[model samples]
Target: MCGIVGAIAQRNIVPVLVEGLKRLEYRGYDSAGIAVLDTEIKRVRRVGRVAEMEAAANEINLTGRLGIGHTRWATHGGVTEPNAHPHVSGDLIAVVHNGIIENHDEKRQALQAKGYQFESQTDTEVIAHLIHSYYVQDRNLFSAVQKAVTELVGAYAIAVIAKDQPDVLACARMGCPLLIGLGDGEHFVASDVSAILSATRRVIFLEEGDVAELRRDQILILDKDRQKAERKIHVSDVSLASLELGPYSHFMQKEIHEQPKALSDTIEPLLEAGFVPELFGANAKELLSKVDGVLILACGTSYYAGSVARYWLESIASVPCQVEIASEYRYRDAVANPNWLVVTLSQSGETLDTMEALKYAKSLGHDKTLSICNVRESAIPRSSEMVFYTRAGAEIGVASTKAFTTQLLALFALTATLAKIKGRLSDTQEQSYLDALRHLPGSVQHALNLEPQIKIWADRFAPKEHALFLGRGVHYPIALEGALKLKEISYIHAEAYPAGELKHGPLALVDDNMPVVVIAPNDVLLEKVKSNMQEVRARGGELFVFADLDSHFSESEGVHVIRTPRHAGVLSPVVHAVPVQILAYHAALQRGTDVDKPRNLAKSVTVE
Candidate 1:
C-alpha cells in the first residue's frame, strides 16, 4: 500500500523523485523519504507528509544523478522517521519497497549474527541488508538485487541503488506491480504509471518474478528463469491533467461530481453497439452460454458493487450467484462447480487478496474467468481470460467515489448480456433496458445537483456517534456501501441492515439521539421499507430518507426527506450511490478529518 520511485538521469534526480512522490501522495502514507548517490549515499526522511520531506531535503541540497524515493504506510513499524523507507545498509545499498517481506524476522536475525546492525524497524530494512550481503560478494548492484529477491518470501515491489554504482538502478517485483519508464538519456521505475507519466509515456509492465536493470542508455530485463526476455512496450493514455485537482478543493469532491462523465464513458461503447457477448471477448459468447451459475470475488467497495450485481444476475439471468470476500474465499472449502463463471472486480486491479483468490480459483479448475477493472494493464486483468475496463479516469481519493458507480454500470451490462443469451430477455425488454442505460448520465447529473441540501443534512447530523442505514432487495447492498463510506471517511460508527431484519437485532441500537438513513426507491419494496422507517420514528430515532421524486414524502417532525431525481427502474442503485458519497464527504469536512486520505488507508491495497 506504499509508493516507490527511482531514476537514473543525466541531470540531478532529486526534483524528479520528489515530484513522483507528490503524485503518489494520494495513495496514502505516514512517512516519506528519499535516497540519492551524491558522492556517498545521502538520505532524508520525515514522519509526516511528503511536503515535510521536501522541506527537509531542500535544506541539505541533496544532489545526484541516481535516486530512489518512498512513501510508507506502516505495516511492521510505527510512524517514525527511522521506520520510513529508503532503508540503508552499511552506507552501500539504499532500498525502497512496497508490499510485505514475509520472512523478515529470520533474515534479520541471520544478518544480525553476521554483525550487520539495523537502523530501522521495517521489513524493508532486511531487503537492503540482504542485497548488501550479496553486493559485497559480487560487487554488482543488478546481480545483488536479483539474488536477494529469490532469497526473500512474500509479495514485494522494490527499487535499489548502490553507492559504488551511481549510474545504474535495479528493480524487481513478485505479487506486486512495478514498471519501467523509458526516457531520452534517462530511465525510471515506479509502482504506478502516473508517477512517471510526466517524464515518459513509454513504459514496460514487469511480470511476476521479472527483474530489470535500468541505465542511462539501455534497459535489460530477465525472466523468472534468469534468461533474457522480451516484453511489449505500451503508450499510456492517462493525461497529466487527470491527476491535478483543477478547481476542486478535494479529490473526493471532484470525483463525486465527475460521476456523470465517468458513468457515460464506461457504458458509451455498449450503448452504441447494444449488448453483445463478443464485446467482452471473441469467445465470451460460447463460454457464457454454457455457464450455469456466477461466482463473484472482490474486496471492500468493489465487493458491495458485486453484492448489488448478485441481485441482478439471479433475477435477470435466472442464475444462482454468490459473492465472496476475496480474502476469505480461498480459505474455505466449498462445492466447486465447473460450470460457474468466476468474475473478479478491482479498481487498481492489483489487490493482493483478490489476485491470490483469482489464482486459487483457477487452480481449482475454474477456467471461465472474467475481470472488470479500471486499469486495463493491471495484474488482475492480465491474469484473467477476459477483461472489461471502467473509464473512471484516475480515482486519487482513498475513499472511492466514481469507481464504485462505474462498476455498477458495467455489472448491469453483464446482466443484460447473460439474460439475452439465455432467452430470458425479449427483444422489446432488451431495448427498454438499453434506453435506461442511455439516460443514466442525465439521471446521475440530477442527483449531483442535490449536493447543497445533502451538505446541510451532513452539518446537522455530523455530531452523532452512531447511525443505522436500511434498504431492502437490491438497495440493501447500497446501504452497506453507504455505511462503509461514512465510517471510512467520516470516522463515524455506522451499520447497515435490511429493513426486514431491524426487528431481529438492530432495532435496539435506535434511540432519540441516533440518526437512521433509509434508501427508499419507488419499487416493490418501497411500502415495506416505509414501515421500517416508521418503526425507527416510533422509537424516537430521526429519519433521513433519500426518496425518489415520485415517492410523495414530506419533511415532518423527526423525519427528513431528501427528494432524489427520477431514476430508471433497476438502474436506481447507480443513482442512489451519489448522495451517500456526498453525505460522507461533507460529514468528514465537518469533523475536520482528512477527506481524501483517511487514517490507516491507501488508494490501492497492494498488500494484504
Candidate 2:
C-alpha cells in the first residue's frame, strides 16, 4: 500500500500535507514525494524515507495552497527517485496513487501511440498522462478524471491536482480506501483517517466508484453516473494521545502492552452472549448449520492468526480448515466448494491482496464470505456477507501485536460457536473453553508483567545480529510470528522453524553466538519442545524460553526463562505471544531502529 495526502485551504497547505504524510508513513515508506502548486510550481521527491523527502523539500520552495503527497511501497517499478509517486505530467497534472492499474500495458501502449511520452516505468504514471490526455480533450479537470478513471480497470485511490485548478482537488477510489476530512476554510483527502487526525476529526469515507471534488471549504461526492450523492460525516474518537507512544519508547512497545485490553474488548461481547452471535448476526445458527469447511485468507500477522485458527477449528468445531496467504491464494486455480466458508482477516480492512482474494472467491459463486477487521466501514467488511469487528483501536505500528491477538480471539470465538451449533463440543467442554477464554484477560495482564524482564533479556541479546525461534503444533505459527516481528522492526536476521525441523537443516545454523527463542509453553508438545531446546543448548546456543509458570521447567546456565500464566493448550499461544512481541520491540529500541516505521514494509499491502 501507498500513503496519499492532499489538502486545499485558504492558507498554505504544504505543511499540512507533510505532517499528514509523516503520520501515514506507517502505510508505506520505500520512497516519499510531495507536489505543491504554489505561485508557479514545485515538486520534491526522494528515494528513501520521509526524512529524506523533508530534507529535499527544504532545498526547494514548496509553498502552495493545493498539494498532494505520497509515501510509496513500490510495485510496478523498482524503488528509485524516478519511480516514486506524485507522478507529474508535462501539463502540471500531478497525482498521488495508492493502488494498481491492471490494464496499464494496453493503456500505456495507446498513450504512447498518441505521442504521450512517459518518464517512470510505473503503472501510476499512465494515470498522469491519461488525465492530461482527457483534460486536453474535454478542457475540464473533474470530467477528465472521471473519463480517465472510467477507462482504467483496476483498484485505485487517486488524488489529482492541476496547476490550472490550484484551488480544487479531484479524488476517486475503486476497491481501495479514501477519506475526505472537513475543516474550517480547508479540505483534506487521504488514504486513511490517520493522515488528517491532527488537522480534523470529521471525515467522510469515500465509497468505491465515488468521485469527490474537494475545494477550500467544501467536498462534493458524485457517483459513477455523475449524480450528486450524500455522504455522512463520521467523527473519529481517536485522540492524538492514543497515537503517541507516551511513556513507551516506541509504538511497537505501546501496542504490545495494549494486547490485554485489545483481547478483552474483542472477547467480552462473545463471552457475555456465550456465543459468537455478532459475527454472523441474523443467520448465526443458520450459517453454521450449513457450513462444511472453512478457508482463511490473510497476510502477515493475520496469516499466523489464521494458522492458529485452523487448529482451533479442527479441535473445537471439528471443521477442516485451510489457511492461505491472500496474494497467492487469489492467483491459483483453486476450487471453492459451495459449502465452504471463506474468512478473511486484516487489521486495516483495506489489505489489497486479502480483499482481492475475497472478491475472487465471491466471483466464483461463493456467497458465504466473512471478514474480521478493525475498521468499521472499510472495503473488506463492506464486501463480505458478515463482518467481525476487532476493537484493537488504531494499531499504528507496522508490525502488528494487538491486532494479531484480537484476530485469534475472534476466530476462536467463531470456532466455539460453530461447535455449539454442530453439536460437536459437549456442554462441559464448551464451558471449559469458555472459562479459559473468560480468564484470558487476566492471563494476558500477567504476561504483560514480564515486559521489564523481557527488556532486560533484550538488552543482553541485542548485540547479536541473528536469532532463531522454535515451537511445535499451534506454537509453530506463534514462533513464526515472533521471528517475523524480530526481523521486521529489529533488522535482525531471524528464522522460525518447527521444532521437529530443527535437525533437518536449521541445526547447521545454530552456534554459541546464535540466540534461540523457544515457545515452550506446557502442552502435549512440551516435552518435544524441551527436547529441541536441549538440542540447541547442547550446541552452545543461548536459549530464551517462554514457559508456563507451573510447568516442570527449571533455569539452566545458558537458558533464560520468562514465565507465563498457566492456561490450556488451546490458549497458550495467545498468552505466550506477548513476550516475543515485547522482546522484538525492546531489541529494536536497543538497536536504534525505527520501530514504528520499518524499512521496505507498509502497514497495509494494498498493491500486490
Candidate 3:
C-alpha cells in the first residue's frame, strides 16, 4: 500500500503536500517523493522516510501552487531512488499512484513500441507514460487522466499534475481509495482522510470509477461514463489530537494504552437501555432472523477478530459460522449459501483482496452482505448492503492495537443482536450482556495495568528465536493474534496452537530456549490448557502466562505467572488481548526494531 496526497491552492502547496505525506506515514511506505508545477516540473525523491524526502525537497526549494506527493511501498521494483514515485513523463506530466496495475507488462510493451522510454521497474511508471501519451494528443489534463484510467486493468488511486496547467490538478481511482477535500478557493485529494484532515474535514469520497478535476476555484466530479456526478460531503469527527503521541515513545505504545478509551467509544452506542438491531440498519433484524448461518471474510488481524466471532456466533447466537481469509476465499470453490449472512471485516475498508473477495462472493448470488469497517465512506462499506462502523478513531501504528480490540467488540455486539432476533436471548439476558459491554472499558483498563509485569516477560523473550502461544476455544484466536503481533514487530519466529493440539505436533518444538505463552482465562478450558502448560514445563520450556486472579496458578521454578484482572466470561478475549499487545510492543522496543513500521509490511494491504 502506497500513500498519495495532492493539492491545488492559491499559495505554494509544497509544504502542504509534505505535511500531508507525513501524516500518511503510518500507512507504511518504502520511499517518499514530491513533484511541484513550477517553471518546470520540479521533483525530489528518496528511498527512505518522508523526513528524508522533506530534507531533500527543502534543498531544492521548489515553488508552486499545485503539487502531488507519494509515499511508495514497492510492488514491482526494489527500494531505490529510481523506483520512487512522483514519476514524470516527457517534460510536464507528473503522476503519483497507489495500488497495482495488473496489465502493466502489456501496457509497457505497447508504450515501448511507440518509442516511450521507461524509468523504473514499477507498474506505476507505465501510468505516467500512458497519461502523457493522451495529454499530448488532447492537451487536456482532465481528459488525459480520464482516458488513461479506462485503458488500465487493475486498481489505482492516482494524482497527476502538468507544468503547462500549473493551476489545475486531476485525480482518479478504481478499486483503491481516493477522496477530495473541499477548501476555501482550494481543493485537496489523498488516498486517506488522515492526510488532509488538518486542512479540511469536509471530504467527498470517490467511488470505484470516479475522476475529479481540482482547480483553484471549481471542482468537477465525473463517473466512469464521463457523466457529471455528485457525492455527499462528510464532516469527519476525528480530532487532530487523536493523531498525535502526547506522552508515549511511539504510536504503537500510545495505541496500546488507548484501548480502554477506544473500546468505550466503540460500545457506547449499543449499551443503551432500549438499543435495538436497527442500530446496524433498519432491515438488520429481519435479515438476520431469516439467515440460516454466518460467513465471515477478512484478512490479517481482522481475520482473527472474525475467528473470535465464529465462537460467539455459534455459542451465544446459536448460529453456524465460518471464517475465511479473504486472500484465498475466491481461489477456492467454497460453497456459498444464499441464506448465509456474509460479514466482511476491515479497518481501512480498502484492503484489495478483501474487496475483491467481497465482490466475488456477491457474484455467487449472496445478497446479505454486511461490512464491519472503520471508515464509513471506504470502498468495502460503500459496496456492502449494510454496515457497522467501528469508532476506534485513527490508529496510526502499523502494528494494530485499538482497531483489533474494537473489531472484536463490534463482532460481539453483532452476536448479541442476532441472538435476540433469533429468540435465543431473553430481554434480561440481553441486558446482562449489555451490562458487560458497558463495563468492558474498565476491564480493559484493568488489563492495561499489567503492563509493568508483561514488560518483564518481553525482556526475556526478546532474545529468543522461537516461541509458542497456546489458547483454546474462543481464546484460540486471541492466541493467534498474540503470535502475529510478536512476529510482526519483534521478528521472532512464533506459532500458536489450540492447547489440545499440542500433542499432535507442536509439543516437539518446545525446548529450554523456547518461550511458551499461555492465554489461560478462568473458563472451562483453563484446566485443559493447564495440562498443555505442564507438557511444556515437563520438557524444560519456559512458561509465561497471563492468568485470571481466581485461576489459582502461581509462579514456580520454570513458570512465570502474571495474574490478570477479574475473569470476563465471554468478553475475556477482548480483555486478554491487552497483555498480548503490550508484550509485543515492549518486545519490539527491546529488540530495537522499527515497531511502527515493520520490515516488508504495509499497514493497509491495498494490493494483492
Candidate 4:
C-alpha cells in the first residue's frame, strides 16, 4: 500500500510531512516525494526511501504552509522518479493518491481528447489533471476535488492542494482508509493513523465517499450525500513507541520479540473474565447460536492463520470451517449460506482485497460477519457485524511477526467460545484451555529463548536457495506460514507440502541442496511426520525440524532439530509460529535484505 500525508498549518509543514513519511516507511515504498505550495509549487520527488526525499527537501530548502507527501508502492507504473507521488498538473494542483483508479485509462483517454497531455504513467497523475480541469473552471480547489472524485471509479484515498488556495487542503476517500488529524493551528490528513500519530492524538475517521476540507484550525467534512457531517474525533491510544525500534536493530526483530506480551494482551482479559458471547459484541451470543458454519476470507499471513483455525474449529467447536484467499474469493461465485458466519482476518484491517471480499459476501446475503484484526478502529472491523480485536499493537514489519501469532490466539479464543456456546466443551475442558492460555505468555517467552539457536540455523539457511517445509494434520498450516516467512523476508524460494504428499510428487525435487524443514510438534501425527522426514533424509536432503520439547528428535549430521518451549497442545500452532518468525528474521539479517520492509511488498495491501 502507498502512504499519503498532508497538512494545512500556520507554519511550514514540510517537516511534519517528512516526519509522517518516515513513520510510514515500514509500510514499504519504492519511491518518495513531496509537493509544497510556496511562491509556486515547489516539488522534490525521489525514487527511493523517505530519507532520500528528506535529504532532497533539506538541500533545496523546500518549505510551505500547506503541502502533501507520499511514499508510493508502485501501482500504475514502475518505481521511477517520474512515477513518484505528489504528481502535479501544470503547477496548479499537486496530488498524492493511494489506490488504483479502475477507470484510469478511460479517464486518461477522455482527458487526452480534451487536449490535456500526461507526463508519467500513473493513475495518480490523471487525478491531478482532472482536478486541474475542474479548478480552472471554478477556481475552487475543494469543490474541484469533489467534482473530480465523483467522475472517477475505483478505491482511492487522495489529498490535493491547489496553487491558488494556500490555506486549505482537500481530501476524499472511497473504499479505502483515510482520516483527518486534528491539531492546534494545524490540520492533517493521512492514509494510516500511524503516519500522523506523532503530530496529533485526536483524529476523525472519514466514512466512505466522505470529503474533507482542512483549514489551519478547522476541519469540515461532507458526508456521502454531499451534506455537512460531524464525525467523532477519538483520542488515539497508539503509543509513539510503536514506531520506535527500541533495543532492536530492526522493526521485524522488535516485533518478533514482542509476541509474548502481545499474546498476553490478546488472551488475558477473555481468559480472566471468562469467555462469554458478549466478548465479541452485544448480539454475539445470538449470532453464535444461529451460526451453522464458518467461512474465513483472508490473505497472506492472515490466510494461513485462518487455515490453522480451520483445524481447531472442526475439532473443538465441531463446526465446518472453510478458508479462502480473499483476492480470489471476491471474483468467484460459491454457495453462500446466510447462517454461515463470514469471518475476515487482517492486521491493518484495511487490506483492500479482504475488505472487498467482505462486501462481496454481504452482497450474497452473508451479513453475519466477524473481524479478527489487530487494529482498533479500521475499515473491515468497523464494517463487520462483530469484532474481536487482537491487541498485537502496531505491526510495522512487512513480514508479520506479532500479528500472526496474536491472530492465532484470537482464533483459539473464538474456537473455545463457540465450543462452550454449543455445549461441545465441558466445564473441565474450559478450565484446562484457560490454564494453558494463562501460561502461554511464558511459553512464548521460552520460544523467544530459541532465538540464539535459530540464528545459528539461519546461518545454515542463508547460503541456500531452495527450501521445502513439511507438516501434517494441524501443523500443516504452520509449515506453510514458516515457508512464507522464509521467502518473504529472506528472498529464498520456498514451498510447503503436507508430509503425506511428499511421496506423491514433492520427493522428486528433494536433494542435498534443498533444505527440508518440518513442523513436528508432539501431537498425534508426530510419528507420521517423522516417517516423512526419513523420506527426505533418504534422498540426501538436509532436514530442519521444529520439534516440541518431548518430541525426542535429536540434532544429527543431516537431521537438525530445534525444540520449542514444550508444547501448548491445541495451542501448539501458536507456539510453533514464533521460531519460524525468529528464523526468518535472522535469515534475512544474514542475507542482508530489508527485514521490516521487504522488496515488492508493503505492510498493508490497500490496493488490488
lDDT of each: 0.92, 0.88, 0.90, 0.91
Candidate 3 Cα errors over 4 Å, as ranges: 273-275
Residues 1-608 of candidate 4 have per-residue lDDT tens digits of 88999998888889999999988876657999999999789999998899998998999898999999999898888999988988999889999999989999999999999998988999999999999999999899989988999998999999999888998899999988898999989999998888888789999999999998999977789998899999988899999987899999998889988988999899877886677788889899999898889999999999999999999999999999999999999999877999999999999999999999999999999979999999878899999999999999988889988999999988888888889989999989899999999989899899999889889999999999999999898889988999999999999999999999999999999999999989999988988988999999899999998999988888888999888988789999889988988888888899999888888999989999
- Per residue, candidate 1 scores C-alpha lDDT tens digits across 90-149 of 999999999998999999999999999987888999999999999999889999999999
Candidate 2 lDDT tens digits, 1-608: 78999998888787788888888888888899999887545789998788889888877756888889999998888999999989988756999998899999999999999998989989999999999998877567888899899988988999999878877799999978999999999999999888899889999988879998998877789987789999888998777877877898778778888887888888777777787555566765566678899999999899999999999899778899999999998999988887988999999999989988998998887888889999878889888888888889988889999999999888988888888878887879878887888889899999999878999999976899999999999899999999999999999999999999999999999999999999988788888888888899888988998889878888889998888888555888899888899899889989988888887787887777
Better of 1 and 3 by lDDT: 1
- Model 2 spans with C-alpha error above 4 angstroms: 47-62, 77-80, 216-218, 224-228, 426-431
- Please give the range of 10 consecutive residues that has the lowest summed lDDT in model 3: 271-280
Could you tell me how far off, in angstroms, the CA of residue 356 lies in candidate 1 after the best superposition?
Answer: 0.5
Clashing pairs in 2: none
Query: Model 4 segments beyond 4 Å from truth?
Result: none
Error of 1 at 244 (Å): 0.7
Native-vs-model 1 lDDT?
A: 0.92
